[model samples]
Target: MQVSEFHLTAYSTALFSTWIFIEELGLLFDAGDGLSAGLLQKARKVKYVFVSHADRDHLAGLLQFQQLNGRADGPLIHYPADSGSFPALEAFSQRFDPHIRGEAWRGIRSGDALPIRDRITVDALRNDHITAPVEWAKSLSYRVWHKKWKLRREYLDLPGSEIKDLIAQRGRAAVSEEVATLMVGYSGDTPVEDYGRWDGAKLLIHEATFVRKEDQDRARNNRHSSLEEVLRMAAEIKIDQLVLSHFSSRYSAEEIDTTIRRYGREFRVTCPVYRLLPGQIHRDVLREEPVWSL
Candidate 1:
């Protein structure tokens, strides 16, 4: 769960609420109800927020969040460009909290990249969770990338003096090229459609709202992923850690964990697997003992 130094905290429950706060990046993935209450003063550190879709369970706490921590210089919120609910809510937030201003509310589409830091950027990828066509922008997933440079393989054995001299003559860019590493991938809410969507991610946080194929029928009215489908997909991908959330309250914690253990063994999964149980706030979720450890 620890990708370099980022600490992730979250609360998720299907049809009720869901949100994740990343401490190192000052970023929040969603703004479900009780966000302000759960994070308290720590919520002030959030400088950027990405909302996945227009579902009420995903955005019910925006008003409280804005009122509590919104300022002229912090907490920019982004959402799908075609989600009309956001614009209307933005206008309502402005009028409801007349004293709050300068908080940027932006409309973003797939393929857009927003820099969270000088060397870190968050990229959005469209996902099929809102029943919108591929041309429409109604839902999204996010990936956080860290940009860095390392000595070229050919120059690794070069003398320090020569390397410094080469840098003076040709600049550091001549010897090294920038590379981006996928630190974390957030699959907001979607069906298990692409196994490669989160491949090679150091950590992946995904939603598994149902436990079985039979239960998936109940979720058919809305787009969602089932636990079996998600784990099956994870077994095929290259991820260091997997955190599943947004499970329905219908299943008990024991039921969810038991099912996860069975799947982990059946799929021969080798990475640590974690789950966020219903009606609970998980702090430093990665640090907690995974439901099924490697």
Candidate 2:
């Protein structure tokens, strides 16, 4: 319903680990190290796991997670179609464990919107984190949408009884149409590129792998975002609330928080900004006080 209601628990560190668990949707975005241990028994609730890329830091926990939670029903996993790592992992996992079902592993590409729950779908959109041919889907960003049928504008003034009668006579489609709301978005391991994808989202979990521009610029092969760049994008875009993750270990928590507060003021961003500190597992991230909101 709202970003805060997602019950998000996450942990992220640049080149080390990154994962986000949204309890309400039973969705885990990127299965990095320690995911199973961090969530414990709650990991069983994961109905969908979306891997962002082939980077080991982003998907190292898949084997252990599959071992612990795999079943016929699913913890259905979707990864970039072009990334060979997922298929390799699936092979080794099935061979080693021999019991974990490999049936639900799926290869996905950009623009694939797979349903995770009734009226809710997760869309995989390609990001520029890993470069390849235009057709290759190596890295991704994801969005969760909640779709529901609402009364058409023409039927908005009708009485409840009349609406029910109309529905019975003409069918629901005659008076109602589906409307979708962008509930949550996860920008998995990416540099700041387009701000429009996350516009009007209820919440966004984005990666900010560096605090300094020089460090960000140095990593030319596999791209990453600087804290300033992300904040700048946030200022330009329309988003309700933001959660920044995947900060480099080089920065102390104090420096990260201070920079956020400073840049937040510089950018004049109004939305509440939450963050996952480099080495900590942020539990109920929305419940904690944000680093900046003005």
lDDT of each: 0.90, 0.90
All predictions: root-mean-square deviation over Cα? 1.5, 1.3
RMSD of 2: 1.3
TM-score of every candidate: 0.96, 0.96
Give the poorly placed runs of model 1, Cα more than 4 Å off: 1-5
lDDT of 2 by residue, 1-294 (tens): 555666988999988999899998899999999999898998988989999998999899988998999988998999999998899888888889998874578999999999888989999999998878878999999999999899999989989999999999999999999999889999998888878899888898999888877887787675888999999999998889999999999999999999999999999988999999988998899999999998
- Clashing residue pairs for model 2: none
Q: What stretches of model 2 exceed 4 Å from their correct place?
A: none
lDDT of 2 at 273: 97
